[model samples]
Target: MPKFAANLSMMFNEVPFPQRFAAAAAAGFKGVEFLFPYDHTPAEVAGWLRENQLENALFNMPPGDWAAGERGIAALPGREEEFRAGVARAIEYAQALGTKRLHMMAGLVPAGADADSYRATYLANLRFAARECGLHGISVLLEPINGRDMPGYFLQTQAQAHALREECGEPNVKVQMDFYHAQIMEGDLAMKFKRWFSDIGHVQIASVPARNEPDDGEVNYPYLFRLLDEQGYDGWIGCEYRPRGRTEDGLAWLAAYNQ
Candidate 1:
């Protein structure tokens, strides 16, 4: 069976963060991922994970003004210092929390910003971050968001993420294959999975059309899960979906799967 992790940010919004950790453990998940744990002290987060016997599968680096339309500026010109500081802080937090994967949010580009300049800046920042993370034994992942969900985001396709990884030429940096965004930006989920499996460091999922539970929408998850098994993907598949109803109530499909 694929190792499963609950995306506490999306899956257990109805519960408090610490409580979400406990709930995920009770739900039979081996690991958990969250947006950011910066609000709480790293020691506190680490304690919670150890108490629950759950792994921190992934977490985001600081996203400066991501909600205010500033989007990611990790690769934006003149923001190199800010990006480096963010990566350093993220590495510190990951080390404290015993996290192995850090998702680097490549911020949004300003209108008419030179694409070449932004790409160059991004590559430089990635090289530095990857080298630093390598020393700490942590892998940094780049995620591509869907334009429909997050307009003006800098990276929005697997192809772009793959290219950036190639350009960076760093073994510690890889793509975070979010199935929800990939399904929206490009179809052929299984084939894409096969093609980019080597470059991928982590995977997240939610059903299409509704962004709800895996069984609530168009994506055939059973088939997809089977495909993942066939491909020998041993990484955590995060349950990163919003609950249309009570969180536990929405998880009925998982019980059915178990049965």
Candidate 2:
């Protein structure tokens, strides 16, 4: 069965960030994930997890200036120092939170930027991140966001992500296969899952086009869930979607699988 983790960033918005941990647990989630936890102390976040008994499945390495719209800095040429610092900061939090996986966002590619240079920078930064994270038993993740949702984002396809992972040649660097982006860019979710089963480190899901709960989407999640079980995928499937209504009201689809 698919082990679902609520994305506290998108779900349980009725309360503040700190309270979402309990909200997710009360809703029967065994695990949880979020975009960034830089605003709070690691001890604070850790306390919530320990209190709720929810496993911290995943979280992204600090994306540069999120409010300023810098999705990530990993692919930016001159920001290598800042990117490395972010990696160290992320490791501190991961160690405190006992999180094993961290997603390294590829920054938005500036217009007129040299594609080759950006690719080189991204690859180098990824190798550095993998080495640093490996020392602490943490895995670094690379995700491909669709152009429609995140224009100019560096990584965009399963092939591209896998290729980069191979080029990095680091055992701990893996791909974060988000179905929301995958369905938007490539519709063959099952085939992609099977083809890259060995390289995937994490999974995320949301309805296509609407980015809502997976129950009423173009993608048949039930079929894919069965496929995951058949293939013996023992990883957290993050519910990284916005609810159409209240978050709790949209959990009927998850109730059957929560057990």
Candidate 3:
């Protein structure tokens, strides 16, 4: 069966972190992913995970204004120092949590920023972060957000994310394939899954249209789950979506596959 990880940020909003961890474990999920656990010390977060016996599937590196229009310039000429510091902080937390994967937020490319310069800067930062993560046996993943959902984001396409991973040439750096965004930006979901499976380090999903429960929207998640199982994809498919009602109310959809 495809292991499911509740996205605590979305699922258990209003619940304290420790409670969220325990709730996910009680719900029969073996793993959980949070948006940013840095607010809590790594040791504290690690202790919670151990208490619940859950794995930390994925967590974001500091977004650093990517949510505003600042677009991450990890490769920006003047921001190299800031990027390095961010990576170091992330590594520290990932180590404490015993997480194997860290998602690098590639900020949007600035207006009039030379593509070559941005690319070079991004590649440089990625290489540096990859080395740090490699030392801890952690893999760094770059996620491409949809321009529709996150306009002006730097990495928006799987092809672009794939190319960046190739250019960085770091074995520890790979792509995070988010099905909701991919369904919007690129169709032929299964084909993309097949083509990019080799480079995809992690996966996340919510149903299309409403971005609610998997059964409440257009995607055929049962088939998708079956595809992942058949292909032997052994990564967590994170439940990253907005709850249409109470979070637990929508969890029944997972029963289809959880059984």
Candidate 4:
């Protein structure tokens, strides 16, 4: 069976952020992950993880002004100071929550922005983030988000992520493989998983074409789970999907998998 972490942001919407910790624990998830935890103090978030006996699996760094249509500022020109500062804040939260990995989103490329400029800023930011996070024994993961869900999202393919990681040359930089995104972009799931296994640090799952529970998607999750197990991918598979029904009710797939 595959070990899954409830994506608190998407899964436990029945309650508020603070309460979702207990909700996930009750749902048989040993770990939990979310997009961001900045609204709550790290200490407050840590208390939730500790009291619920859950592993703080993953989270993203402070993306600038998320409400202002800013997904992240790491690749935005002239935001280097803010990007580095955000990394520090994220590291504090990771330490407090006992999380081992933090994801860095590459914000949209500004229209008319120089392509080379975007890549340079992005790689530089990733290098700094990876090095800083490394000091605290945390890995920095770069996730290639599909443009369909996030139009203009900077990183949109696994190969792009790998290329950036290599360019940054940071030992702590690794890939956060989301099967949903991979399927959307370039999917040969089993083969790609094996090919990129060494560069991958985390995994996430959702159905293809319609980001729903794994049971109803084009993906055969049972076989995928078996593939991961056989390949020894010992990382959390974050359940990041929109539920077809009430989130709990839609978890029959997980239940059947004995998660």
Candidate 5:
């Protein structure tokens, strides 16, 4: 079975952030991932991880002022300085948390802008972040989120993510394969998963369309998990899904998979 990581940002909402680490541990998750760790001091989060005996599977680089509708700044024009600064800050936190992966969210393309301009800016920013992250033994990932979730958001397909990574010319840059996003944007999940398996560094899962628990929707996660095992994918699979009820109640699928 693929190793599993609890997504603290989306899961375990019944408890506070700090307490979620212990909650995940109690629920049998050996690793964890989250959105941003800016508010909590690195030392504080490190302490929690140590206490819970969980590996920091993954976390995203800052995406600018999230409250102001900025999904990410990497693809935004004239934000190179802010983007690089965010990369540096994320590195500091990653080092402290012993995390080896960071996802970079490509921001939305402005209404009047074209794909060429956004791609150029995104590639440059990814290269810079990839180099910085590479120095810390971390892989920089670019996730292709679906337009339904965030319309106009740059980078919305596996092919586009691969193209950007190649254009970035940074060996450390890789793809964060979120199955839920892929299912939303395209069908034939298993075929695409196999096709792009090599380029993927980290993985996330949720149900299709609704983004709920994996088993509740169209995606057949068990077969995919078996395929991953057959292929020897030794990375963390983040349970990046929302619960239909209590978070703990939704973990039956995890137990079934482990068996």
Candidate 6:
């Protein structure tokens, strides 16, 4: 069976951030993931995971100036120093949380920006992150967010991500495949998963167009779940979707899957 991890950032909003650990555990989740855990100290976050007996599935490295509309700095020129500092801080949290996967967001592209410059910076930054993370036995991840949801985002396609990964030539650097974005940008979900199975570090799901529970998605998650089991994907499948109602109440699909 494929292991599922609750995305604390999106799910279990009825409770406080710290309390969501227990909420996820009580809802039958053995692992959990979130966008960023920088709001709380590593010790505090680790304590909650220990208390709830939940494994930390994955989390993102700090995206630069989130409130000011910056998505990430990994691809932005002149932010190399800031990006490296973020990587170190992320490793600190990963060690405390016992997390093995870290997603690195490629920052948004400026209007009339030089693609070559951004690509060069992104590859260099990814190589740096891969080296830093490899020493600690952690894998760095690159995700392709659809343009519709995140306009001007530096990364936007699976092919592009894979090409960049190949160019970086780092074994520990892998792709974070979110099915929601995949379905939007590239509809051949099953084939794509199979094609890139070797380089995929993490998986996530949500309904296409609506970005809700996977139960009603355009893509058939049930079949995909079976495929993951058959393919022997021994990785956590992150539930990174917003609930239609109460997070727990909207988990009928999870209950059904477990049954």
Listed in order, each prediction's TM-score against the native is 0.96, 0.99, 0.95, 0.97, 0.98, 0.99
lDDT at position 64, candidate 3: 77
What is the C-alpha local distance difference test score of each model? 0.87, 0.95, 0.85, 0.89, 0.90, 0.95
Candidate 4 lDDT for residue 81 = 93
- Root-mean-square deviation of candidate 2: 0.6
The residue-by-residue lDDT of candidate 1 on 71-146, one tens digit each, is 6667788988888898889988999989999998888777888998988888898898899899999998999999
Candidate 5 on 1-259: residue-level lDDT in tens? 7889999999999999999999999999999999998989999999999999999999989999999999999998889999989999999999999999999988988787877877888888888888888888999998999999899999898988888788788888889989999888977877877888888999899998788888877888898999899888999999999998899998888997565
What lDDT tens digits, residue by residue, belong to model 6 across residues 60-120? 9999999999999999999999999999999999999999999999999998999999999
Candidate 3 lDDT over 1-259, as tens digits, reads 8889999988877587778998888788899998888778888899989999999999987767645656555656778888888888998998889889999887777578798887888888899999999999999998888888777777888999899899888899989988898888876889989998988899999999778878867788888889999889999999999888878777887776667
Q: Which one wins by TM-score: 1 or 3?
A: 1
Summing lDDT over every window of 10 consecutive residues in candidate 3, give the lowest-scoring window.
66-75
Per residue, candidate 4 scores C-alpha lDDT tens digits across 1-259 of 5789999999879789999999989878899999999999999999999999999889999889898899888788899999988999999999899999999988998677798898889988888898889999999999999888888889999988988888888888899999999988888878888988999999999988888888876888889999999999888999999888788888777786662
Q: What stretches of model 1 exceed 4 Å from their correct place?
A: 256-259
lDDT of 2 at 186: 83
After superposing candidate 3 on the true structure, give the runs of residues whose Cα lies further than 4 Å from its correct spot.
66-71
Give the clash count for model 6: 0
lDDT of 4 at 75: 83
Clashing pairs in 4: none
Clashing pairs in 2: none
Clash totals for all models, in order? 3, 0, 4, 0, 0, 0
Runs off by more than 4 Å, candidate 4: none
